[model samples]
Target: MFRVAVICLALSFSLLHAETDVEENDIDIEDESELRSKFEKFKVQYKKKYDQAEEEKRFQIFVENLKASKRMQEQDIGTAIYGITKFSDMSDEEFGAFYLNPVISNNNDPRPEEMLSADVAEQLTNVSLPSFVDWRKLGAVTRVKDQGLRCGSCWAFGSVANIESMWYIKTKKLRALSEQEILDCDFRSTGCHGGHPDNAFRAVIQLGGIMSEREYPYRGRNGHCAFKQSKAIAKIQTYRNIRPDEEEMKIWVAHSGPIVISMNATGLQGYRRGIIRPGAYACDNFRLNHVMLVVGYGTSRGYPYWIIKNSWGADWGEKGYFRIYRGEGACGINKLPITVVI
Candidate 1:
């Protein structure tokens, strides 16, 4: 009963945003000297070492991204704060190539007949929904992971996270599962390029189970399959897609476990912290390019947000996590939510 209610809430936030546009000059321009100084500081902070020619090229890109971040801050309707991040030095195209996976958004494959669909109603009935849910607090969530610039493997990380939490929820044992195994053995996906979470889940079942991170550590790039059946640690029987309702998603998170979701990550490159609620121009709902884990949800100072676990390392947004506006399908978040059955 509770699972049904939760799925409904998750779907509500997936369709509330209307498409809109913003002017190109929405950002505030800063002095050149000040911008340069900040760039130097950014380099020092991130330990960035570049040749003279590359330094100049990267500095210009950094400046442009700074302006873009400022524009996002000014045009944002929610309380999201934007600034320089580890990705600030890369251009939009570079960032997309390095981190975002296009296959997820372009995937048109039919759902498998054997794959179970989430049994959820459109709205809550007698089951009471919690106002908040945080799987990290419940010890079901693992530490934030880093996918690195070498691979666009957020799909593997997202699926692994969901499986880890579900495995813990069922067995009372939390294990950092191996995404490298999927990156290498999941022939259904293009290693270091992109993949679909459902594909990862299916591959897990086919491969018997996944190994622990210690046994099959991530290399941030494609490698020959080194999966040892003897070291397999966690497994899933099947996977389910939640109803496209935000309310139901919330209920599901509160009652079940974390969910693997794909969304538009255009505005995430410069995100520092705070709940991001950007306009459609900044974060298009139809442009889903990145996959992440929905660990929990709650309201922040009147702004309802989904606590998302990103695979961008602990130095990024909210210590390797980010919060997106709820009930609005922000960044196409509710477009594709899938979880595993352990």
Candidate 2:
């Protein structure tokens, strides 16, 4: 009797274990089904089409990216929201190749020897900086632009953005400048692969001036130089590199106009909206990768942030703009504060 009872007990234990396994498998299937639904919606929302094999591959990547986004959301110290974006389907390497310029992060190009004029320097020195400044609100900023895929021409876009703001502030006329002109003509740096804003500034000076977007439109690819000297509307004689201090940067932006800056864009991969205060470890101060325009600065929910204009289009990150924590030099923002002198 004892032997029969022991046999029955072992069989019951085995059946219970099998039942547990089946339940876990059901949960996994449900999870995968949900993910598939989300992926289908994502493709539809972004207008993405893929072959059968490529679709499977991209769905896997999207799953991994979603996991990473969740990790980012959990780890973020600020109010940043991380979720599906236009880049959700891409792997990190593919995303970096298409959007970011890693070369700019380690750029060691020689600075121009030109200095700010004495009068301009005196004016900047004496002008009292306001607690907040928004070039967009002041009508100095143009509409946010989109730099299409596989073209890492952020340097040109950033440089042109600052120039447009400076030109508007000086002339009271805002005109969209051509980034393709810089990509085509600026031989100092590689065109679409990557370039520096300083090189772009020098290119503008050498090319005499930059033409309006109407005359030389953006093609999102490299092309032969088609710049017409006669069509040039705005010009810059020189550019100034500000000291890597947030206070000085604010003063400069308040008195002059928007400034071009480069910073680590790793955190931006998962960024959707809200002021990004990712803390120091999440966004390294030394690993700069993407260049952008600093159009304004202000405080939000007791956190001071820098308003940055991005080249990723109007749909991404606060209408093609983002804000980062100001005082801590978050993501190496203060490392490369540069602006053209109009």
Candidate 3:
């Protein structure tokens, strides 16, 4: 559910800029100087010290980000607060190609629906829901933060991470699962291009589970499957879809383990830090393209939010974690939630 929201979020934002060009040469000298001054100050505050060799390249990207920042601020569009960050050095195209991957295949066209069995999604209205849950802090998920790099295999990473978390919960072992295994072997998915995490999970089960990362390092690109039966470290007998209800999702995560979800992540690209609540940006307007895990749920500033774990590397956005507004189907977050039945 949340996955669709994220997928849509990224896709809409990407589509909005696909045919446009960034013209940077016409900046007035005064404005350019001010932007440079702000960028320099931001760099100092963040300790993003660029020595002489990287200055020219860094400055170019900084200028682009500065222009974007001013434009966004001037329009006063949406509620997300934008600023220069570690990613202030990468252009939108480079960032989209590298760190951002929205599911762009046919599955993206009609808006995805629950595919597996006709088993109507169960309503967990009677389920015991917790007010707060933090799986990362509780030690159920032992893996460290991960980076998807240039691959569009967030589906693979999200699925593998959940399986790995289940391994820890059931067997008391934390083995980093091989996402590369899925990237290479999962024919049902599109590897680095885009894929459904649900399909990736099905691939894992059919392949008799996955191996540790030590057995197969992530190539961030599609390659031959080198899955070794002897190296299998984690397994999922079956995976099921979670009810597309926010309350039910909280109950599941708090009681069971982390689950993969989707939501509008377009705003996340510019996120520096803080809880995200979209204003003026509605869910119906975006497309779902990205996939990630819902690690936990909590509140800040008296507002409820979901603590989502992204695969865009720890260097991005709050150490690769984000909090989106909870309830009212935040950015269509409670849309197509799925979990593994290990």
What would the TM-scores of all predictions be? 0.88, 0.85, 0.77
Model 3 alpha-carbon drift over 4 Å, by segment = 1-31, 40-81, 101-123, 282-286
Q: After superposing candidate 2, which stretches have Cα over 4 Å from the reference?
A: 1-30, 104-127
lDDT of model 3 at position 13: 14
Which lDDT values do the candidates have, in the order given? 0.77, 0.76, 0.66
Model 3 agreement with the true structure over 55-137: per-residue lDDT tens digits: 87888877777667555444432334455555667677766656654443343343335533233325353556677888888
Name the regions of candidate 1 deviating beyond 4 angstroms.
Answer: 1-28, 103-118
Best by TM-score: 1
Best by lDDT: 1
Better of 1 and 2 by TM-score: 1
lDDT of 1 at 226: 95
In angstroms, what RMSD does candidate 2 have relative to the true structure?
15.6
Estimate the TM-score for candidate 1.
0.88
Task: Write model 1 residue lDDT over 40-120, tens digit each, in one string.
Answer: 767776678899999999989988888888888888889887876777788988876656644332335555544434356
